[model samples]
Target: MINYDLYIDGKWMASTGSSRIEVEDPATRQVIGSVPRGTKEDVDKAVAAAKKAFPEWSRTSAKERGRILRKVGDLMEQRKTDFARVISLELGMPIRHVEKWHLKSSIREAVYFAHMAENFEYEYEAEGGWVRREPFGVIAGLTPWNYPMEQITMKLFPAIAAGNCVVLKPSQATPLCACMLANIFEDAGLPPGVFNIVTGAGGEVGNCLALHRDVDMLTFTGSTSAGKEVGALALSTVKKITLELGGKSPLIVLPDADFRAAAEEAVYSVFMNTGQTCCAYTRMLVPRKNKEEIESFLAEEAGRYKVGAPSDPDSDIGPLISKRAFERVKGYIEKGIEEGARMLVGEVPGEIKKGYYVKPVIFTDVTNDMTIAREEIFGPVLSVISYDTVEEAVEIANDTPYGLDSAVYGPAEEAYEVGCRIRAGGVHINGADAHITCPFGGYKESGLGREGGTFGFEEYLEVKSVFGK
Candidate 1:
């Protein structure tokens, strides 16, 4: 029975628009809550408040800003249980994973950004005189439904640490967690209008935020097509834009790699977060000689993933964010079948009965040009393509417009070499896990700018070179 409202300026208020978005639990197909369908008017009010807060907020001492961030982190940690529950219920993530990874990981990211801000050199002597990193004034942070807290924290923490005010627009599908985040900032005593949350459709609130004249920067995380629109709109006013868009990344399995280990890691990499991750390794490139063996192993491993209720502790996969996403994933599965890709594992549209569930799907003998291999499905679907040599593997991996992330699986030395040759921003060797302290982003259409560690902090800042005295 939680009543969600837009957090504009320093107060929680109802949207001026007549429209409202109903939040639903994908697993049960039940309406959880309703969020206001914010309009351009709402975006204007938020940007205005942020602009007004910027003068004082940007001038605040870095130490004080860091202190505030640290306090926000502490508050979030205290409410970890509640946050995890909300995420699991809203996003249909397993409760155990929500606690182990989503909630805990997001808190760590905030803490990491706070620590980085404390020691960051805002002003430093360089070649001629001094260089300073200044805040970009008001920033609009548009986050996605998947990894709601993580995405929000990734953008908002760094923006605030760099002394900028933020107007965050979390996805209407999972706006509850963002509301809780706003509560954390309020309880942490963040200055009025320094942080705001507005929930609505991307067409309305997102577009308005990007086109708002007062907004100095627009940070977006979503699909490539949506990103194109946001980028174009932001460019109209020439606002600074940081886009972490879609990725159809590749995971290369060298001939000498352990077939069992590679297959297991590949399935986990692509299927985690229900394959909704922007950088999910959807395309797997294996040596032609070992294709049959790897394909068999992948089929076996895919079957092991238990897809069911999010509340079930043993459930390995959950429902898509909504009915639309469910249909989209189902449609892609069907497309793979029609396009001549062999369905090596799982069924199309998955088990029928309830919710927005889709079983893990694997396609073998897939070509790079196939729709399943080329497009970003954003589902628990994997396409296995065979490559004749390491050179061909690199070519296939680099063929995609995205360069967000890629993985090299083989003997330690050989994998390292291949990783060096890959064009992605982050390369995982031998299934090495994602590191929070490292910079994360794509090289090409994957994204603009990074979103982790000190590299991420730079996105919220503008460099100014001071002339010699």
Candidate 2:
């Protein structure tokens, strides 16, 4: 197994304790790697380093910062294949998608943020006064395992480009990518201590980082329940915080759309990344008259997405991240049947003796109030809810506590108009392209702050107003 050490103050050192957390390959259930199980002591040291590095780093020229970040993107491009393979092994995503969705997106965002930093107006005149965007010191970032490589890159690129130091605590289940990234940053010539990493349980290292007095800002991406705990801890210090939490997002297939294409889009939204995506379109709202026809198309599309090992070139889907996650997805399927939702595409499997795999599930005749329709089931499961009217479809779409990502499949004019009514942060109309420069976050309980483009970059910055500057 590959063993790793905690990275603090530009050095990779063993933790204060001898404990290490083993990371398993979801496809094989074999221990593929291990990282030091960090303690509060480690968090303290990382935070101290970040806090010490913040002053000079914050004052460094944006041009210089952009150069380093741009170099990081260049190096990541060279190792794209290596990064994709590791993520496929650790997170159970198919190799075909890992390169396109995870690694390429990370590299693109890094480059995008680098250019943004170079041209960003840190200070602008506003109504007879000058407003400045200043970096917050010692940001504590916690990322989830679903998109291990991209998640940390999503936070780190902009946060560092904004001239803030960060102490990141990646999910212990998939941390090898984090280790790889730290090495890249070092190679990119980032100033010592401008970035740090501590890997361990959320309760230990994450908790310490959240409440650490030196941390001026907190950014987290995970489940809603865990986010609340972290947000609470950060609140104790009254630090600036951003939480990108759970989502039960929806995809509305309007009457005017092509049933075949819309059905395909719906399945892709959920089955992509094995449905571990926080912003996945779990709920599908279709017109009542076309429900059965659309259901048939959905099932057929899902059938094409076959499950196999991540190493297999043709595998469309792979295993879940862990046994616990596998069991959780199974539990949700059982619950869907109990709630009287009609099973269209999936069933609870009879014990498979090997990998943590589950058949993709789709439930029809679902109501907004059903547990299956409302909760965020982070698996390859979709809830198909039929609506009588366009207004009803919009209402059902907005019924959930989450308002993350969503989509509307219909004629151009109709879809755009309907998309505007949804409460979600993003609405994909007619298979719109999702670039790295869009503003991404959620409304309501799904999240607190944006994570891409101009708004996201501003999250790490504190606003200042200077009169007659």
The lDDT for every candidate, in the order shown, is 0.89, 0.91
The C-alpha local distance difference test score for the whole of candidate 1 amounts to: 0.89
**Predicted structure 1, TM vs. truth:** 0.97
Predicted candidate 2, C-alpha RMSD:
1.1
Per-model TM values vs. the true structure: 0.97, 0.98
Give candidate 2's whole-model lDDT. Answer: 0.91
Native-to-model Cα distance after best TM-score fit, residue 278 in candidate 2, in Å:
1.0
The backbone clash count of each candidate, in order, is 1, 0
lDDT per residue (tens digit) for residues 1-469 in model 1: 4568899888999989878888888999888888899988888888888999999998888788888888898998899989988998899988877877577777787778878888888899988899998999999999999998988998999999889999999998899999999889998888999998888999888988888889999999998889889999999999999999999889999989988888998899778789998888899999898899998899888878888899998998888888888889999999999999998888888554678888888999899999999899999999999999999999999998889999988999989999889899989988898877898888888888888878889989999999896
Give the winner by TM-score.
Answer: 2
